[model samples]
Target: MDENSHPLVKAALIHAQFESIHPFSDGNGRLGRILIVLYFVQSKLISQPIFFVSEELERERLRYYDLLNGVRGDQPDWSSWVLFFLTACHRMADKISTKLDAADKLAMDGLRRCQTESEKKVWVYTFSDPHTTVKKVSTQLKIAPSTARSALNALATKGLLYSDKQTKRNKKYVNYDLLGVLT
Candidate 1:
C-alpha cells in the first residue's frame, strides 16, 4: 500500500490479507496479529509495538473471528472487518493511555516517598525495570554497591519497594505498586 493511505486502513488490509493467506498450520492467527504491530513498526508509524491490540481482539474473540470470516466469504465484507480492526486499535490505544497515566501517578507517588537522591533514583529505576538488584541499580545509576543497597533497602523500608528476601547476595527488589499500574 502507498504511504498516502490512512495507517489504520493499511494495517486493517494487511491483517485481513495475512489472515486470509493462513500460511502456517498452527500459528497463522498469532503471526497475523503480530503482523499488525510489525507493519506499524515497518511503516515508521510507531517506535515500539507496545500497542497490545491482541488484548482487545481476544476480549472480543467471537466477533473478531466473525469479522475475519466475513472477509473470506464469497460476498466479502471488507468494510465491516476493517471497521472492527480499526475500532480494536482505538480501544487498545485508549487502554494503554490509561495505563500510562496510572504509571505516571504511581511514579510520582513513589518519588514522594524517597528520602534521599539515591533512593529517588532507585525508585525511578523501578518504573523502568520492576525486578532489580543492587548491582543493576549501581550499574544504571553509577552509584556504589553499598549506596545502591542502602537506597534499595530504604525504599523497602518506606513501603515503596519489596525485596525478594535473598539476604546474602543478588537479592531482588520489586515495586509492586508500580507493577500494578503497568500490568
Candidate 2:
C-alpha cells in the first residue's frame, strides 16, 4: 500500500484479506484480529498496538461477520466492511483515551493522600497492576518485606487499597480505586 492510501482503509483491506485466506485453520480469527493492530503499527498510525477494536467487533459479532462476507460477495463491495472497521477503530481509541484520563485523575487523587516515599512508590505501582501482594511489591520496589507491608497498610488506611482480613500470615491488598478507573 502507498502512503497516499488512508491507513484505516489499508487496515480494513488487510483484515479482510487475512480472514478470506484462512491460512491457519486453528488461529485464522486470532491472526486476522492481530493484523488490525499490526497494520496500524507498521503504518506508523500509532506508536504501539494499543488501540483495541476486538471488544467492539466481538460485541457486534454478527454484523462484523456479515460485513466481511459482504466484501467477498460477487459484486465485491468493500464499503460496509471498511466503514465498520473505521468506526470500530474510532470508538476504541476514544474509549482508551477516556480510560487513561480517568486513571490519571485517580492516580493524582491517590497521590495526594500519600505521606511517605514508600507509600508513593506503592501508589504508583498500583496504577499498572491494581491487584498485588506485599511480596510482589517488595520484589518490584526492592524494599524490605516489612516496609512493603507497612506501605500497603498505609494505603489501605488512606482508602487506596482494601484488605478484608487483618491477618499477616497471608494477606492480599487490592487497589479498588485504580481497578475502578480501569474498568
Candidate 3:
C-alpha cells in the first residue's frame, strides 16, 4: 500500500518492507531509521523534525532488526513496533531535555566569562552547533575572519571548546561537553 492512504499503517508496513527489500547495498538500516523520522514529520505527527532516536535503535540494534524481519515475515506484530517507537520518542525527549539543561548552564557560564558581545555571540552559536568552524561562524555572523578566530580562540582557551591540532590550516573546534550532554 502507498504511504498516503494510511500514513501510520503505511509507515510501519513500508518500514518493514524496506528492510526486507534492502534497496541500498549499504546504509539500509540507517535509511530505514531515517524513513521513520521522515514519516513522523510528513504525517504531522511532529511539528518539528527534531525527534531523532537513531541512537536508541542502534543501542537495541538486534531487537530492531528482528522486529522488522518478523513483521515482514507474516508474524506481523504492529503493536510491538508502535510501542518501541513510542518508547524511543520518550527516551529521545528526555535526552533533549537534559541537553537543554546542560546548554543553559553552558550559556550562563559563557555569559560570565565572555569579555565582549562578539565573544558571547560566538559562544552561543558554538554551543548550538558544536562542530562548526571559524569560517562558517564568520559567514554566519557577517564578521571578519580575524574577529571570528579571536572569539573562537578565546572560547577554546576558556575550555568551552577544544581545538584539534590537525595538520590542516583550518583546524576544527568542538564543544566536547555539549556532545557529552547529548550522548
Candidate achieving the largest lDDT: 1
Total colliding residue pairs, candidate 2: 0
Worst 10 residues of 1 by lDDT: 163-172
What does candidate 2's lDDT look like per residue over 1-183, in tens digits?
456779888888888988988888598887788888887888898898777688888879999998888878578778778889889888988998899999898888888999999999999998777888899999998999999999999999887899876576768889887777667
Put the candidates in lDDT order, highest first: 1, 2, 3
Q: Which digits, one per residue and each the tens of the lDDT, describe model 3 over residues 13-108?
A: 667777889988899988987887898888887677677777776778888777766666556776787567567667877888888898789789
Give model 1's TM-score versus the native structure: 0.93
- Model 2 lDDT, residue 43, Cα: 85
lDDT of candidate model 2 versus the reference: 0.86
RMSD of each: 1.5, 2.3, 4.1
Candidate 1: C-alpha lDDT = 0.88
TM-score of each: 0.93, 0.85, 0.69
lDDT of 1 by residue, 1-183 (tens): 667889889988888888888888899988888888888888887899887687899899999999988988589998898888889999988888999999998889888878899988889898888989999999998999999999999999888899856576789898898778777
Span of ten consecutive residues with least summed lDDT in model 3: 1-10
Overall lDDT per candidate, in order of appearance: 0.88, 0.86, 0.79
- Candidates 1 and 3 compared: the better one by TM-score is 1
